[model samples]
Target chain A: MASFKQIHKEFVAALLVPSAPIPKGLVALKKPNITSRFAVYRNNVIVGLIAALKSNFPICFALVGDEFFKALAVDFIRKNPPTSPMLFEYGDEFAFFISQYSPADQLPYLADIARLEIMWRNAYHAIDAKPLDIAKIQQIDAKEHSNLTFKTHPSAAILKSNWPIYSIWQGHEDNDMVDIDLEVKQAILICRPNVDVLIANIDPAACIFYSAIMNGRTLGNAYEKAIKQDQNFDFNYCFGQLFALGLITDIAAEN
Target chain B: MSNFRLKKIPNLAGVGLKAQHYKTILQEKPKLGWFEVHPENYMGAGGPPHKYLTAIRELYPISLHGVGMSLGGPSERLDPEHLRLFKALKDRYEPWLISEHLAWSTHEGKFFNDLLPLPYTEETLNHLANHVDEMQSYMGKQVLIENPSAYLAYESSPYAETEFLDQLVKRTGCGLLLDVNNIFVSANNQGYDAYDYLDAYPVEHVEEIHLGGHSVELIEDDDLGIGKLLIDDHSSAVIDDVWDIYKKLIAKTGPKPSLIEWDGDIPEWPVLFNEAKIADGFMKKHVSTKVKS
Candidate 1:
């Protein structure tokens, strides 16, 4: 008789990887063969994990359809089982999965869409915080304003995708936008300063600036990054838009 | 958790809350005992899940049923991160009841996402009791451990299913959430009488009851396929046999807080409520008022 630890080790292997026999001493079912009965547990675990993936990656599921997505989910789950009890926490690496998956290579943008969805979920569950208003920005010391590095809201995410990820996600979510111009760069901004998960398609240059600022660069350096991305980058317009959208929550001025 | 109890639940039939019915439930606010949620679903920071749950929780007494605690995890330890989230939720919600499965869903570093079975032995029982005690102490509230539906039983098992639960209850002071459908399904798969198992059940320790649907599969090898295999999928309406078993227990124990769990192929609000009404019909038939509430 295998110890409980050995049985679990073997059982988990059978559940994930193929070709391992069920652990020993399973009560002999005279009628139903142990293989078929045991498959129920196998089926249940796989099906449940797949469902969690499906829930987290609905847009990916919709793009690929049911059968294809289920197969993809099964493959992903075997390689990357969840480490947390929270089902929502599963599938964090799915976007990368799609990127490397040979079958999904045809749709390169599929991975970015998964990234966007996961970010949306992150924003949805982010810690509740009051975003910085115009008053707080105006209160900054005038001399140190240029050295300000903004603190990102816990729910804020700035995704810079060369692929038109925003339009692709928007098309499926709201509009039936099928024939999108793939050449157009979609710099997407996601934030939940309040209850709703907000998504915006911002200028690529502004996203570069926002990313730098969120990454702890001073406003001066961030502006340079933005200008490098787009020489025509409008600092006032972009910063105004970001502040108005509540993406820039807290600002720290450097000495 | 607050030392002050919020409110008490009636020994009435309730249905597991699904997000699809959120709008209908908020608008209708139907007559139900209380709502139960897999706390994992709302583990996210803030969003529609919390919003809708808050709306419903305001109108009804909520119960938090954890699916991923892996209380009986092979490591014989609970995940600190999971425990932190569970504790945070317990503080915020102060639900009428908090519960987890007797089964383990994790091993080593990987989580399986299903209620995996455990061996019946002194070592296993001691570990489980310690885990349950830690969980209850951490939460500062009585936690109910649920009986799981087993696909196969181990031959090395020393104690009967009911006796194991009884001993665990005595050791940890944790109450039992007797899942009637699990009893029926496990009894069928293990070749035992569901009624007899319920009769031997520690009725005094049962805090809640669960009724769900199970389907039987023909033994693949049998040429006649006369041999049956029961699968507790929790899909569709609760069947007559499970209902009968539930009634038999209720007759002996009187009214207890019961829930109808239809996780698979979840139906609309009316269909689910109707299932609860069926369980309610059984509850009304057997016992009049609450006894072991």
Candidate 2:
């Protein structure tokens, strides 16, 4: 009788790699063809995992097309099987995997596009938070403005990329008519107003400002850094846009 | 009155709640007996998943069906994070029943994202039963263990599938979800008698049931195409054969909360609800017969 550990190892190995030789211990007298039988099970296992990945990363699959993506997914699954049983939570490092993959390297922006998809997914699933009320903003004294710390909405995401990720994503969307240019650099803000996740482009200065706020910087310091990056940085326009987008959810004076 | 009282799930038919129908289900307030969601989908702190689930919970009983527990693994250690999330979900939703699959999904800390089959033996049963006991203890509630739909079975299993299930329930006091489609799929794949398997099942421990659609693939060997056997793909409409088996099981087990699950290639709301309606009709018929008798 094979030991339980040996049989399990063999079973998992067989599920991942069909051609791998089954560990010597897992033998049953009636069914000597354990190899072929397990192969069928292995196929089902891979197919299921691949389908889950496809669902979780539909835009990534759409970019590469099904045939190539499925092949790539098979490779990705073998290399990095999920760390959690929840299929939705699987593929955390898929974008990073595409970044390092040789075949995917030619599409230099694929990784960033994958990141945008991840951000959209995160925004879609992030916790609901009440947007900053204009009434609350009126309560802050002009003297305390410099000491006020702004907190980004729980669902706020800032993504910067050289490629037009928003256009790329919109181009592949169902019933979308926008033409996409793969070469243009794009900076995007993804946030949820109500239940709908909205993605919009912003200048690099605003991206930096929001990134600083997200990193727990005070509004005054964030503005100073934005001004340093771009002398023409329009604080009024940027702040107004952020507020209008419902990005800032909480404000506190630095203690 | 304590609002946290464990609401007993009605012995009627329900449907797996999906994001696509969240608004409609909440707004229309369909008369669903219960709703089941994959707990992992709502593991995040605050999100649409939680918001919708909270709204829906007020109207119908909920069950947390976990897909990631990997109970059949050789290791004695269960994932603490998974346990924490399950605890959080239970606290938030106060689900009527919590359940996991009878298969292992992870090994050596890597999840395959599929419910892999287990060899039914003394060692395997002991490993799984211990995990079930641990999960029950951690959650402070009994869990329903569902049978996995396997494409192949290992010859090493000494115990029959039903017997293995019976022993697990006996050892852990856990209930069974008794997925009828999984029974049909496994029996077809292993060339076992499906009805005999059902007949041998300990129906008293079955707390809920699942009915789902499957796809059939024809196997060819030596230039001969054999009769088709089904695979539990959860991608199609529930077939007549599976429904027939479901009717039989409901007739025997009496009315229990049944869920119409269509996870892949999901149809429109009405089509999916029609499937639930079929199961609901059967449950109602059983109820009327019981009262008449």
Instruction: Give one digit per residue, the lDDT tens place, for model 2 in B1-293.
Output: 22455677888778888889998897789877888888888887666777788788888888999988888876777898889888888987788989999988778888776777777889998888899999999999999999888756666789988899999999999999999999888787666778998999988889999999988876543223354446777888888889899989988989888998898887888888888889999888877988999
Off by over 4 Å in 2: A22-37, A173-183, B1-5, B221-225, B290-293
* lDDT winner: 1
Calculate each model's fnat, 2 decimals: 0.69, 0.48
Angstrom error at residue A45, model 2 = 2.6
The sequence of per-residue lDDT tens digits that candidate 1 reaches over residues B1-293 is: 54334756679888899989999999998999988899988888876787788788788887899998887777867787788888888787778899999898988878888888888877788888988998998888999999999978777889877899999999989999999999988888877888889889898998899999988787755433557778888887888888888888888778888999989899988999998888888788665445335
Report how far residue B263 has shifted in candidate 2, in Å. 1.2
Cα deviation at B192, candidate 2, in Å, is 2.1
Worst 10 residues of 1 chain A by lDDT: A25-34
Q: Per-residue alpha-carbon lDDT of model 2 for A227-247, expressed as tens digits? A: 999999999888787678888
Candidate 1 displacement at residue A153 in angstroms: 2.1
Clashing pairs in 2: A82-B111, A127-B46, A162-A185
**Candidate 1 lDDT tens digits, A86-189:** 88868899999889999998888888889988998898887777788868767877677778787778888888787998888888888587789999878888
